[model samples]
Target: MALDTGMKCIKYLLFIFNLLFVISGCVLIIVGAVIEANYRTYLDFISSSYLSAPSILIAVGVLIFVVGFFGCCGAVKENHCMVVTFVVLLFMIFIVQLGVGIASYILSNDVERFLHENMLKSMRNYDRSRPGVIKTWDVIQHDHACCGTNNYEDWTSTPYGEEYNGVPDACCKEHVSGCGRNIFNFSQKLNDINKEGCFDKLKGDVEENVTILGGIAIGIGFVQLIGIAFACCLAKSLKRQYETV
Candidate 1:
């Protein structure tokens, strides 16, 4: 049951590819976790369906790592059953990953609207004491040194407008102890207002992160195509062993 030179070459190639696949899977898991953990500021604007994508990638990454092990073992042992199963799993995972990437790209176009709406809505809920989304707006506004969704005046539409009767303290000028106290008199404090908005910055950050994730998906997808081709070739070569016998 000797394998021909070509079959041996393909088999070895498949093993090497699977080893790389394992590493790739581990990377995806790490990347996904980071996205899920640190994306709170941006993801808070996205719906649950879009937000769950990172978690799904984490799960798929773990699965790919496990499945890749089967592939390496099958290629080494020249086991037909294992090789076939590995090929099937790789193909399925490849489709899923590509789909995720495409979907992410599509969503990016409309994400600006969601971000604008969410930020405006969140302005009304800005409070340090309350939990969940209460702190999200404050953190983004304070850390990013911006106000409202578009500018200082965006807050005027929210109930927060009446509650604070002016801009939040987070929108104050530097070194001004009671900068926001003049919130009522925008004309008097024309030089003190923070004219920049949070929407553009937040939108930029979200686009950047989503672009990275989509790139990961596309990159892995290409590798899966190579792996699938190698597996199929090696599977065919396995039949050569029987022929020789």
Candidate 2:
């Protein structure tokens, strides 16, 4: 009688786990579908600097849902075959995610390098004579230009032709040459450039997030596999008990 009671308890637990797994899986699937559908929109948002982080979260959410569903079904059926299948699926997902994350990191690094190199070249070739280019240069320079003032001398004190002490007039000249404008104007332009870059970075972050989500889904799937194993053991034990009775 005690053996029968234990079997009944084990069955009930398996049933509960299966139901929960199914529900979670469904939710994940829905979430993944939504994210997949809006992937372009999310990328656009990153491009616009409106949002950071994308696709990864959605992908992970989807995986979680699918794996959970499989786990639930396996538990309900007490089928070791399904449980093993789910485990294999999870392992594959994990491997794929690891590959993607590494690839993305490499790609982003390459892109950053390219952008930095090109921007440097563009700055060097910039035509200061062109009004638009000059204006743009001035905006960029003023914002990023840095100068240090000596404690012993006041920069504002040198009015008109008064010889400025400590600080070199060449400093201002360098700033003007680099940005093609005064610091104040350059600062504003720099801000605009930074805003655009921020958006691009956010998009990259979204892809990274997808990889992270995949890792997490893999973990959850692993746990579900353990649960399925436990369920199988319980089912076998119950069967043995019933046979003895």
Candidate 3:
């Protein structure tokens, strides 16, 4: 009777853990979606492949939801096969996530250089189209309170820069009415032009966020230990109970 009671306690405890796992997965999906949406402009500016991170988060979240369901069933039914499968799958995912988190942490540290390089290349292509590229730059500059990838000097080398002879109106301070004139020589508007670049600001923010995310992933990966131990114990207890009967 004591053993049966202990087994029941383990089963319910595993159920609660798996339930929380499912909830965590859902939270990850929402977080990924929010990040992707917030950075869509940057994604559009850079390689589309940059989107894989958020997409993977959503995919992993769904996978966790499914796995948690299996574990929940196994705990509820005290089925040895279900519990074993759950333990194996959960451990595999935990290992995979640990590796992914570590790699992300290391790679995120140096990603800013790559962002700067790619952003410079993307800037040259900015004026290739009229409204398309123009709007992206305008929106990026306006929203970020930044001028160029590096600074206003970035525009000076471009063909469009030669024709326009000045920075975009988006670079002007909020209070400035019209920054249409030759901003470089215009001493009055010089004070209004935002010399700060978007890449530095954006990259710094992203790096901080990535570090936080990597830490979170590593922390969550360790949580699988609880599921694995509980599932294994519950399976063994169930097996023993069946044999003794």
Best by lDDT: 3
What candidate 3 gets wrong by more than 4 Å, as runs, is 1-3, 27-42, 127-140, 159-163, 175-181, 184-188
- lDDT (tens digit, per residue) of candidate 1 on 1-245: 55778888888999998998788789989999999898744554434466787998799789989889989998999987889899999988888889989988988887788778766766666555434444566566788888778888876666666666667666766635556554655677746767689898899888877888888888878878998998988877776565666
| Candidate 2 global TM-score | 0.40
Weakest ten-residue segment in model 1 by summed lDDT: 40-49
lDDT score, candidate 3: 0.79
Q: Rank candidates by TM-score, best first.
A: 3, 1, 2
Clashes of each: 0, 11, 0
Against the reference, the lDDT scores of all candidates come to: 0.77, 0.46, 0.79
- lDDT tens string, model 3, 46-155? 55576687888788888888888889888877777888888988998989878878988999967898788877776666664645456777788888889889888888
Poorest 10 consecutive residues by lDDT, candidate 2: 146-155
Which structure is stronger by lDDT: 2 or 3? 3
lDDT per residue for candidate 2 within 144-245, as digits (tens), equals 342221211222233211222222222243433333223233454333221222223333555566556555645654655555565556656645655787
Q: How accurate is candidate 2 locally (lDDT)?
A: 0.46
Task: Name the best candidate (by TM-score).
Answer: 3
